[model samples]
Structure formats: structure tokens, C-alpha cells
Target: MSVKPASSNRPLSPFMIGPYYRAQLTSMLSITHRLTGLALAFGTVFLAAWVTAAAAGPDAFAVFADLANSIVGKLLLVAYTWAMLYHLCNGIRHLFWDTGRGFEMKTAYASGYAVIGASVVLTAAVWAFALLV
Candidate 1:
């Protein structure tokens, strides 16, 4: 005789199941840090292409420059800038954790927020400087 397994009632996707399923700052920061790392990896391909274009000569470099100066490219640059800043700040937070520090819940949460705040402030400051100069 074949028997079916009994199922207990529980959400397979905790995120969608309840209003109280809100993500904690630490978890969100962890996911964001990993995502930003991946984004930087992908952005590196563009960086390599730009360098190759420069080596190829003025015409190729000009094409690369024009594309980078376009609106979509500007948006990608902004995203890459933010990702770099976020990854840098989060990496420092991870370093502190590596030293066996900031394990307290309050400290961890505060550091997570600090990383996010620093990334936004630094990214905006860089863009502002770029635009004004």
C-alpha cells in the first residue's frame, strides 16, 4: 500500500505569509551586500571593455565614451557607484564581525543602518561632485 505524507500547515514562503514576516535589518543587509558584490562583478566587464576600447584607439574609445555618457549608461554608472560604496561599507562591517566584535543585536542593527547610510551619502556626494566639476 502506498501512503501519502501528511502535511503540516506552514508557509513555504515566509515573506508572503504574514505582515509580521518583515525582514530584519541584518538579513536585508546581508542580502544587499551579496547582491552588490555580484553587481560589481558584472560592472567589471564594462570596465574591461572600456580599457580595451582605449587600447584600440581614438575611434573605439570615442564610441565607448559616447555610450557611457548616454542616459542608460549614466544610470548604470550610478548603480555601480552605489554598489561599490555599499560593498565597501558592508565589507568593513564584516571585518568587524570577523574580529568577533559587534555581535550584539543592537550593535549589529546599528552597523547595518550605518553601512546603508554611508553608502547613500558617499554615492550622492560623488555624483554631486562629478556633476558640479
Candidate 2:
């Protein structure tokens, strides 16, 4: 008879998933901002659809508009907006580095945190305004 491996016979223990060491904060945030930006770009398809449908005729616009005003649409709008803002700020930071600024380790770290902080602040601000007004 065939026997299972020793490891397979026993129940599995706690498992760690995802990159730990490789996901150093800087690298993690950098990649995430880029990804979010890419997602936001795709989200723009809805924007184009809205504009096109609105221009096409009133009936088409009403349908698209109703969907856009729904809960899921609002959430997507908020997320896409924030993603755009974060990507923009981080991109500016990267551009600065490309221009030979903020290159020193200390400066780079400071700017990285600055981008994170700024993104959070801007994203919250947009939502706050969106909600309040």
C-alpha cells in the first residue's frame, strides 16, 4: 500500500502568505500606487461611457446616470478619485528623483512618507467635500 508523506499526514499549522521581507514599506507603496493608477485608468472607461451616452440622447443618459448615482458607483468614484490623486503625487515625487532631486537616502525616505501623507490627506479631503456638499 502507498503511504502519505509525513508532512501530509499531519494537519497543517499556521501559514504565512504574501511577501514579508520583499514587501519593504517603500517598495510596497510604490508598486501599489502604480497599480491603483492603472486601475483608475480603466475606471475612466465609465467616464467616457457616461459622456458619450449623455451626448447620444436623453434616454441613454438617464439610464447611465441612474447607475452612476447608485451606491456601488459612488464607491467606485471615490476609490478611483483617490487612486488618481495618490498616483499623481507619487508620480511627481518620482519625477523629482528622476531630475536628480530627493536622491539622498534620507531625502528619499522623507519624500516617500510625504507622498503617502499627502495622498491620504488629499483623498480624505475629496471625500469629505463629496459627502458634506
Candidate 3:
């Protein structure tokens, strides 16, 4: 008796889709949450450097102060601020989820959007207050 070989069927053309193809709000928020967490780490490093410089005396503090006043530095500061705010809001969302809340699809989406909106608003308000003070 002869045994038949197994058949092999493969697609003629296999195209790769984008990583975020048709991603839902929750998925997008999940990615953003991780990214912001990383960003906050870098931001903390910068903060630590600033504090260390301040402690090192006038000359060292002057260097950091000058950089902080530069245009690029200002933009980075803003971006870091937003990252912090976004991470904070998303963290609260996750906390709620941990408590067995916002598991529903609609509620999850709503909270995702709300987190984004609240982050923007909080960042803007804090910046405005900083500028005005």
C-alpha cells in the first residue's frame, strides 16, 4: 500500500496590513497608555537632572535654566507635560477597570475618549496657569 503525500496550500500573494489596521478605541488607548508610560520615565530623568543641577549650585543650575528657556526645550517640556497628563488619566481609567467597572464596549470607548479629552484639558489648564502665574 502507498501512502499519499500531504497537500500544501499557500496563498499566491500575501500582503501585510498596518499594525494598527482597523484598531478600536480601546486598542489605540492601550498603545497610548504604554507609550505615555515610557515618555513619563524619560521626563522623570529630565526632572531629576534639573533638580540635581539646582543642587550643584549657581553655575550648574544656570546651564539647566538656559536650556529650559530655549525653544526646543520648551516644546519638549510641553510634550512631557501632555504625556504625564495622558498617563495619569489613563491610569485612573485602568484603576476603574481593575474594580470590575467599564467593561462594556460602549462604556470602554466612552472612557477612552474621556481620558483623551481630560488629558488635553488638564494639560492646557496647567500650562495656562503656569504662564499666567
Instruction: Please list the C-alpha lDDT of all candidates, in the order they appear.
Output: 0.90, 0.81, 0.87
Model 2 misplaced stretches (Cα beyond 4 Å): 1-21
Give the top-scoring candidate (lDDT).
Answer: 1
Candidate 3 local lDDT, residue 9: 54
Model 1 lDDT per residue over 1-133, tens place: 8665565455564355237656778877887888899999998999999999999999999999999999999999999999999999999999989999999999998998899899999999999999998
lDDT, residue 78, model 2? 81
Worst 10 residues of 1 by lDDT: 9-18
The per-prediction CA RMSD against the true structure, in angstroms, equals 4.3, 7.6, 7.0
Q: TM-score for every candidate vs. truth?
A: 0.83, 0.76, 0.84
Tens digits of per-residue lDDT for model 3, 71-91: 999999899999999999999
Give the clashing pairs for model 1. Answer: none
**Which regions of candidate 1 are displaced past 4 Å?**
1-22
Better model by TM-score, 1 or 2? 1
lDDT of 3: 0.87
lDDT score, candidate 1: 0.90
Q: What TM-score does prediction 2 earn?
A: 0.76
